[model samples]
Target: MDTQATSAPAADVTSLPPVEVDDAEAALVEHYPRLVRIAYLTLSARLGRHRRVLLAHRVAQRSLPRGRRVPEVVEAGTDPAYAVVRLATLRGALARADRVDGWRRWARSAGNAVPVPPRVIGLRLFPRAGGSEELALDRALARLDAPARAAFALRGVEGLDEESTARLLASAGVAAPRRAVRDAAMSGVNASLLVSGEFDPCVLQARPTDLVRRRQHVRAGVGAALAVVVAAALLGVPGSDGGTEASGPPGSAQAALAQALDPASLLRADATAWQRADRLDFASWPARGDRTGDQALLGRALSAWGRPGASVHVSATAGTPSTPPAAPPRLLFAGDVDGAAIVLLYDGVRLVRYAEPLDGGSGTALDFARVDGALGASASAVVLARSDGNASYLTAPWISGVSLRDLLSPSAAPQAIHRAADGVTDPVPSAQAATDANCGTAGATWPAIRLTPRAGVPGLAPFVLTDLGDLAPAHLTYATGRGAVPAEATSADATAAWAHSACRLASVRGEGVRTVNTWAFADQPLPDGAGTAQWLCTRADDWSGDDHVLVQFLPPGSAPDTPAAVSASARSTAACGPLQPGVLSGVLWKARDGRWYLLGAGSPEVASLTATGGPRSTSPTRTLVVPARQTTQAELTGRLTTGGTLDALK
Candidate 1:
């Protein structure tokens, strides 16, 4: 058995008080290097390299003495006893340095300084996977919520399991759930390997005496003058030029890095034609460790992924799961009509990734399936789902085209980008089709109802589209008919017409439209006389919200009625007339489940039906209710049997 993997005699020594300061100090002296590395890793991203070194030392100085107050036998051979203490100290030190925003702000700012990678002197948990993996790991770590990132870093980098990880976090004043800790650990390990850096077997063999001398020598070498330079730059100290290095525009190196990683620049090249010639020019990007291979892969992915006549347009802003990526979140755009198979990807700074279209065309009518997108726990394959009667799974290496023909289903589902195909069946008929069949424009297409994708996890939910704009005039006309529409009516006029049609005797005082869940339209609170000449109710429904209309037409002189007021107890109330003793007709709406119902309706004889309170019943009440699904034409037809008007009740 490797003695290095073994722990001290006690597994739970956190609560144990230090029995001997001398013994613990001796052990800490030997483990100082490892402790310093931990502190450096934790603070470097938030504080600049110089400040990180300072804060890291502060953490070590604070942690070493804790061995005396809480003596524990954590030596080089066993798990370090000060692991928990080091993490706690680092968190506190960062707070004191006021570098809480750290490198995070630099990453988001447009033309800031280039990030200095964290330094690693010893210990290789994993071999270098190259700068790409480093970039990937850094992005993954950045996206994690603070608690999750801390829990994951400690558990994975320090080899603490969930239980121990939770305890460590709690000791640092952070409340973490066991499940979240476990999740962070599982998500963090691979990335943490790149982060922890290459382990140094040589450091393991060094004695405490040699490390102490080396530490002192290095401090003496840095000297006061070098510290002064860094402090001056950080403190905005004026120079001979009357400005500091930071006050000047970004240095040439930083400007180049920013340009190389900028997504907008890469996308501009790919706009007119799929094969971006400008991007093909290797001189456009910063020189990479493997420039030849990176350029080749990027070229192939972009060239083969696009279709002729596809117009590239930015679709949505892609964000990672937990933290911001090294580059700003990539901009995801869709190619024109023919390019439905291709989704362009650009890291805010570069076109690092792109999607190649599947071999055969998706027979379904829709080109892209609009679904919620999500990030994976690990670096997962980019999956493609088709309405080709099957879902295809493919993975693109750092720089290559993943053929749709060679698609293979992985044992586990990878993060996918689902695209709906042509000829596929739509759950709800098109707005044109849903309109009254007798209406003149029954076959006309409603651009407002075009299927548009939303940002969410790829495969968890079905891809659905929402209306890009508000309901068209034809749709409103279909719902209320020509009888309700006045000559040259405005949108408000149409609404009033529908209200008057619904309740013939009642004047149209006000009208409103709501989504399925009761989210009001922009014109929800229009004045009594507000009116528009054209169909201007342009409220694009959120795809997740589902575009289902709920019309609430208030009778000229009445208030909206609650469901309870129109049911059971108030059946005998004088205000409720012969209509049904207690039915509400003020709010009439269509439901997705193919049903139409009247809500807050009162007796026709009474202008306003007011309900009196009564006893509650144990049994369910019988009342007309709308199903919360996409409304269909058949249901609308059934409910509007009397020509889209409920005037018969009045």
Candidate 2:
């Protein structure tokens, strides 16, 4: 368990599988070391800095063994680093760092408690160079002070961001206010002398056997840097000859690093493809890690294990049946969900652990599955997402009809449930495919509808809805769209907002704020235009007084007769008309059977209707590829039809 392996990509194994999934994995295993070697070489050749020396050490150790391979590194020119940050395991790596917590923690423990490797100890990855030798950059970079070296390297060599540079520097105890210290670093720093003088001493100390090679490598590196920098200052780097190294001069080594690592570099690399000075050479995306397979198994299993409607929601005060006579009532369980992961709690049959995807993949090895409740024989069953910020409750058994909104106050108590994938707000769709026809895109998977209600809204707070597919991602709209939502029927005072899946009140300031008071009731301020309340007739919908609330659209695809008012029966008509007695009074919630049940109690005519259309085919939805044993397509489709919109987020 080396520290490098503990929390890096190699250990994180799940995600929306990329194209050629198996090939990607195999390629990574086969070519990762070569990729690392190339990066180390290119960077060392230019800046000759060893700031990621520790990282280099880890990289070398992580190489695949004989007959095995590592994933190839995906070269992202400037912004390649940006994609890496999305990965949980990178832990502030200069490049793509996805979910690596498990590996990181494991690496730390392994490095600390385990014995060192035997002779020829290996990470086992092969370098890409024709010679196939590990790039000896560690020796090349060690000559300079950590800050000056990191500044020059991150900015010019590795091409990392200032913030990332600062982070790495800070971690290494080298403070330079991000890239600010670069100004003071470029003197005739004399790369050759430093490598020989400094690297010579360090190599002898760490790997005495490699002295001859270290000496040769360090000399070649320094000599190269001398040529590049001196040439830049004299003839000047191709881009500029503006002023001092401190000023905006392209010749400066510092400027080069900033240019190299800028997250946008890859995005703009093509603009300079033909130019030697500006062209970049690397793959423009995040690379796959070694543990991707495992990540998937664990992610999907926990989601099923913690069936929101099936599991019972219990409060801490709600003790279980099994508490010993003297002990506080606690619960436990050990039954498996048909070979799917089962988290048991002890109400002596009382509390149970509910699982959710932890590292973004599927698995049932009993590894990475988390659940709420106490530990014991129940330990295997209960994986606690600790309450870190405000005291929050973990889902004990995922009680029926309860939306997470009622259970969580995110901004206020974010850290409470420490182990959920992302958080309570990130809705994981049910495996059920409730409807009849193929509801989503032509073959692409779209997830179960996920609707989320606002956190503190009055009556509607407990239930808000949206197809998560509607998340507003800038460049990926087509890929992200779940549906299109029109504005909600707004009263003069309240600014109502309706996305296809959810609706909320956007409080406005000043005079307009005085209009829709939540207290009073009025009918048809649009007086002449009246028959009954319609979700469509925004004008006649609101009551006359300060509080002018009306039935907005019933369900996204419901009929005109399906009055906005919950009381009016689900109107199904071609004209899209309002049904009689169009006045629904409250919020929506799901029932035990999975059908979306409304809560407005006032009118008898109000009825739950099965609307014809599904979620607007706009916002991209999330889809699950459930393994045959865990759930059948029929079972999943059945779970989806229960709600008005098939929204699981709510």
Candidate 3:
């Protein structure tokens, strides 16, 4: 080692001449790999190995000056050009690793900005793996701060003495050069290990990133770009507002709106299409709203549907897609309802409704719901207007008559409700109209729209639909006895069964419920010779393919319309639906004689029942009765005849 030149004073170091750009370039080309290795070691290890390798190369290549002469001063004991480029590379690496403060740091933290090294798409570069000794040395060096790493790399990789390392660290903008040298000494790594190929950036391993994911990202990016361009073009088109035309030449907006707003362009069904149609969905519905002929109103609706403004409030039920329609949709209704101009459109898969203030003010609202496979009862009605705790519906053409029935009053006769010439019914109190105090009360009335289908329509039945704060109301059905299939709540037994289960509908309000079915699963004689009790399971299926299962126990002598005691409830399960019709549940009951018993029951398929934990009991039958204290707890399971074990619903 040239100790004399290495130990030269700081004053002599500051007096060295600047190197020419050509000389600096030549030096960098000759010693590029060594410089990159130094930079790679000096960077913060938080950057992964691949990024560190590429960043090291980037910083080393950027070390050369743009001017004819490099202004950086040279250090003693090193080639003047090499020393200049080396110092630049060290400063660049340290700057990258330094902590950023203020707005730039905040921006990076918020993901609004990122200061990363240049990246090459679909390619990753990393240094080659090395032996255990080299790995241990690399890890130890990584534990030091950036400035200390630079000091250590200078001493170990470049064979520089401590004095020269300290001087170079200070020139690289390190505040505590002597302390950094001391910190580097704490790593205790053998200097020979630092020269291994493991730390060499030039000796790299190149691999391709996820090619399949890359293709997907590229396709998605292209699609998003195209959507943005189309939206921009639509917004820029002039004279597309109603019938007003711009002063300049006609643009694409006029042509687009002309095609979209033309009443002849909309797909409309014949007045009696439902009578002979193959499917009883929205496709068979005829245009019936009074304002269907108003071209201006139709144009506004079509424009908003295609490209809604920022002022428009858009909402969709779960699993409903909110994308713009690909072609002109069928017109179902367009009229003024309540205080808003409403438009209903269907695109075979989704129902889209648009509403704006009738007085031409703001507050436009758009709603969407999935009604893809609707038939018979499910397609009986669509909500026309909802405001002030009341809602109205547009009954289907096949619906011969509409009546209102209070679900809680099973014996009360159905009251006639009037409908306009266009098939829109008068506003009635919605389920949400019930106050919190009376929502689940026995005396509270739950009004449901009862639609009587036209005669001679096979498989068509009267549907009891109730509003749940969604664009489409949920259909309510009932099952009379064990193993009975669910159907419309039209029969005497079915109507009485729904009277007990109607109050439980409050649990699924505003959940985008599509259908609610009440099944009388079991009727077991109570313990202590008490009168028989009924077990019912009510399942609410939502539009998102998720179902909520609730088991209720109606004890003997309960009121006709009294709410049943909830035994067990579960969401997103197949316990009560057709997929797994068998259900097992248990509840602790207190008899009139002041005795406590653990009462358990299962569907007929459950061959045996077992109760364990706090109160132990087993029964070969589907029902289990065991004595227990009031505060006792237990786990129940049932074994089906098919050899499948079912856990108690919770």
lDDT (10s digit) by residue, model 2, range 246-324: 5433534544433322222212222222223221111110111122234233223223222212232322211111111
Worst 10 residues of 2 by lDDT: 470-479
Q: Whose TM-score is higher: candidate 1's or candidate 2's?
A: 1
Model 2 C-alpha RMSD vs. true structure (Å) is 32.4
CA-only RMSD, every prediction? 26.4, 32.4, 15.9
Clashes of each: 45, 122, 0
Q: After superposition, how far is residue 400 of candidate 2 from its true place, in Å?
A: 5.3
Q: In candidate 3, which residue ranges exceed 4 Å CA deviation?
A: 1-264, 435-443, 481-484
How far in Å is the alpha carbon of 570 misplaced in model 1? 66
Candidate 3, number of clashes: 0
TM-score for all models, in order of appearance: 0.25, 0.18, 0.62
- Tell me the deviation in Å of residue 76 in model 3: 53
Using lDDT as the measure, which candidate wins?
3
TM-score of 2: 0.18
Candidate 3's displacement at residue 388, Å, is 2.7
For residue 604, give model 3's deviation from the true position in Å.
1.9
